[model samples]
Each structure stands twice: as structure tokens, then as C-alpha cells.
Target: MIDLSFPLREKVALVTGGGSGIGRATARMFAQRGAVVAVAGLDEAPLLQVAEEIVAAGGQALPIVMDVTSEDAIASGIACLADRFGKLDILHSNAAQTGEMQEDGLIAAMDADFWDRTFSINLRGSMLCAKHAIPLLLASGGGSIIFTGSGKGLAGDLDYPAYGTTKAALLGLSRYIATQYGKQGVRSNVVVVGLAMTEALDRNMPEAAQKLMTEHNLVDHLGRPEDIAEVVAFLASDQSRYITGAAIVADGGFTSHSAVYADMLRFAAMDTGAKA
Candidate 1:
């Protein structure tokens, strides 16, 4: 008989950007499912808060202050996890450069430094984390590596070219990791996320912009951090054992319809009114 309950029991997981938003939600969910979580992030305060919350909830957690942009920092963080937990069963590389769409715009006008910086944090950071953590995963007899991706990576937009490019690169990187290590029992995947109601999004996006996004979504409401967290938790668990090298789109059907979907709907409504 297959055991379905407590799917992540006894697992040791690490989540980058685990201080807040989807990362924090996922860390909490992992702990709830019986995994000991290590929450890593640039800020010690939020990480500690999250760790303490998990502990308060009767789960084990460790807060590690890690700047994903630095290879040394990433390596050191993983080492610390190994030292404390002795093994790693899951790695959720969820950190990325965010909340700077204006600066990440139009390729022709983009600052070279900004472009490089975005890649450093969004793309290179994941690469470094994987590079350091893969050996530990292998030592533990294989594990899951999940990258937090974006819908922008799948489809082009008029804004945030740098952000989109880096995210798209992650899809390729995920595939490469999956191909290279699948036989060794390691699985790599990307969760291509939609706009969620994270603290940053709520603060940064205008009400009109939020409404426009909601209008395009198939669901009546926009996503929440907990929604994406559920997807990440599923990918991290053994329940998804047969899945690998895949980009699972969890965007509330944001990119599923045609570009003219909304316009078509409006036209249909007009035609119906005219007939009536």
C-alpha cells in the first residue's frame, strides 16, 4: 500500500527567499507536512520571524541570513544546512530580483548594470544554489529542486524585458538540470507563477492595473501567496515523483487564452445586446 499521509515527513528542506511571500508560505506548509525547514534570505529579521512562527506552530525551523547574489553566501548557507540537518531532501530556489519593473524595461534603454544585476540575482543566484546543493541532494540519495518562475518568461510583454529574460533562462536551466541528473534520482522543475497578491504586488501595482490583470484571469480572483505555495509544496513532495524537467503553469489561466480573448468576449456581449 502506498502511504499518502504526511508526504513530506522526515524530509529536510531549504527555501531561499523564505522570509516572505510565496517562499514563506511554502516554508510554513513544508513544516506543517512534517519537514524540518531552513528559511534563507537576505534579511535576518524576517527570516527569524518566519522561523520563530514555524517553531511556535510546533514545527522545526532554522533561519539563515543568506544573500543569494553571492556564491560564497549560497555555499555557506547550504553548508550550514548540512551541518544542522545533515541532509537536504528538497531545495526551493524561490528568490529573485523583483519590484523594479520600471527600471527593467525596454531593452534599448535598459541600463547595462541593471540588466546584469537582475541576472545576478534572478538567474545566477539559482544556478549557484543548485551548484552547491546538488552534491548534498545526491548524498541524500536524490531530491527535488524547484525554481520559482514567472508567466513573463513564457510570453513576452512590453515591459520588464530583463526580468522576463532571466526567468526564461531559468526554464532552460531547469531542463538542463533535469536532463543531467534525472538518472541519478534528482528531479528539477519550474513553477511558472502568475501575479499573486503578495505584499510587494499590493504595494506596487495600481488598482486599475490589478483590475486589468484580474479581468484576464480565468478565475474570478487573483492569486494569493498561499496558492503558489500549495503548488510549490506539491512539487517538493514525493507525491510528484514521476514529474521532472517540466514547467508547470499555475497562472489562473492568464496565458492559456488567446490575446484577443477579452476583446472577443466584449464583442460577443455587444452582439447579444444588439439582437435583444
Candidate 2:
């Protein structure tokens, strides 16, 4: 009996930063497919909303208010989930904050405090989540670990200092995890997302920035959170059993061209500034 559906019927998925953005999307998708879902985020309000939505539609989910940077919080939340669900089959390390999504900053110009906070949330946060979740995954006879990366990760775009660097490092982390744990039956991968119409994008980018994104992408339509969730679900499921150490770029031809023109446009802003 080969079932071709997105079969997550008995699996348990732990999604960090699941309150909103790609995290929220993944949580709902996992629930829909029958995973006993655990959503962790700094805020509980939206986490509750996601859980409630899943519950309303006849799915199981547990919402946990936790911090990605705090080891204790991560350990506690994961321990709790493992206790309730008996095992962890999927770990979605997707928690990060871009400090309101800053858009203009060269490396030397970036604040020291901002740099630390950025890596702490993006890189260290993922590691922290992975550290606690790995044992349970190994206990369940291996599973999948998915990290949310970005287009800026593959390039050095001075548009944002900390965000770009941390994201870039995440791929390295993902590769390491995949290599080290493959023999142990665990698989790791990354999703390098392009511009998506998520809450993060809405809060961080300006209208002009959004306009520029739409113009640059091959797909004129902005990607929705659901788009990313679908990919995550696929990776988490056994259907992708053979895929590992892959940085799946989900950008709609945005990075397909491979030139980060984000910096060149800075001169145009400077030119306008000079005229004034």
C-alpha cells in the first residue's frame, strides 16, 4: 500500500518561531497533514491563534511561548513536546528577527550591538534549537531538520549587514548537520527563500522596496507563506527521503539571475541626496 499523499499522519513536528511568517505557515500545513504540531515563539498570542485554527479544523497542536536564544527555553519546550508526543520527527529551525528588517547598512557602519543581536537570533538561535531537538529526533530513529534561509544568504549584499551574514552562515550549518548526521539516519536541509508577502516583509520593507522586488522577480506575483510551507512539508515528509544537504532556493527567479543589484541602487538614492 503505497500512499502518495503528504503523509505526516503520526509524525510530530516542532516549529520554532511559529507564531507568524514562514513558521506559522509551516505549523498549519503540518497540522493539516496530521502531525502533532508544537509551535514555539517569543509571543503566545499568535501561537495560540495558529493552534486554534488547527484545532478548529480538526488537527492537534500545542503552542509554547519561548525564546530561540535562550537555551533553557528551547530545552524546556522540546522536552515538553517529546514528553507529550513520545517522539520528534521534524524540527523546523525557523526563528529569527531582522531588527525591524533594516534596509541600509554597510558592514563597517553597522552597530556592534545590532550585529551581535542579529547573529544571536539567526545563527545561534538555530543552533540552540537544533541542540535540544536532535536527541529526540535521533530517538525517533532519525528525522528531518529544516532551516529557513534567504537569498541574501548566498550573496554579500550591503543592503543589510547582520541579516545577510547570519543567513549565509546558516547554509554552512545545515550542510554540517546533514553530513554529520546522515549515517545516523538524520537529514538536514535549508530553504533559501526570496521575497515573500509575509508579515515580516510587510513590517520591514517600504512600498518602493516592494515595488522593486516585484519588478526584479520573474514571477510578478509576490510569494505567499503557503508557498514556503508546501516546500517545508515536502522536505519534512518521507517523500524527500533521499534529499539531503540541499539548499533549496524557493525564490521565483529572483536569484536565478545571480546579480545582487541591491547595492547599485544605493547610488541612485545618493544622487537624489546630493541634489538636495
**Number of colliding residue pairs in model 2:** 0
Q: What C-alpha RMSD separates each model from the true structure?
A: 1.2, 5.5
Q: Write the per-residue lDDT of candidate 2 for residues 169-223, one digit (tens) a residue.
A: 9999999999999999899999999877987678867999888887667776778
Tell me how candidate 2 scores on lDDT: 0.87
In candidate 1, which residue pairs get closer than 3 Å at backbone N, Cα or C atoms, i.e. clash? none
lDDT of each: 0.93, 0.87
Q: Which ten residues in a row have the lowest lDDT in candidate 1?
A: 1-10
Which residue pairs in model 2 clash with each other? none
Return the TM-score for candidate 1, rounded to 2 decimals: 0.97
TM-score of each: 0.97, 0.89
Q: Alpha-carbon error at 34 in model 1, in Å?
A: 0.9
- lDDT for 137 in candidate 1 is 92
How far residue 24's Cα lies from its native spot in candidate 1, in Å, is: 0.8
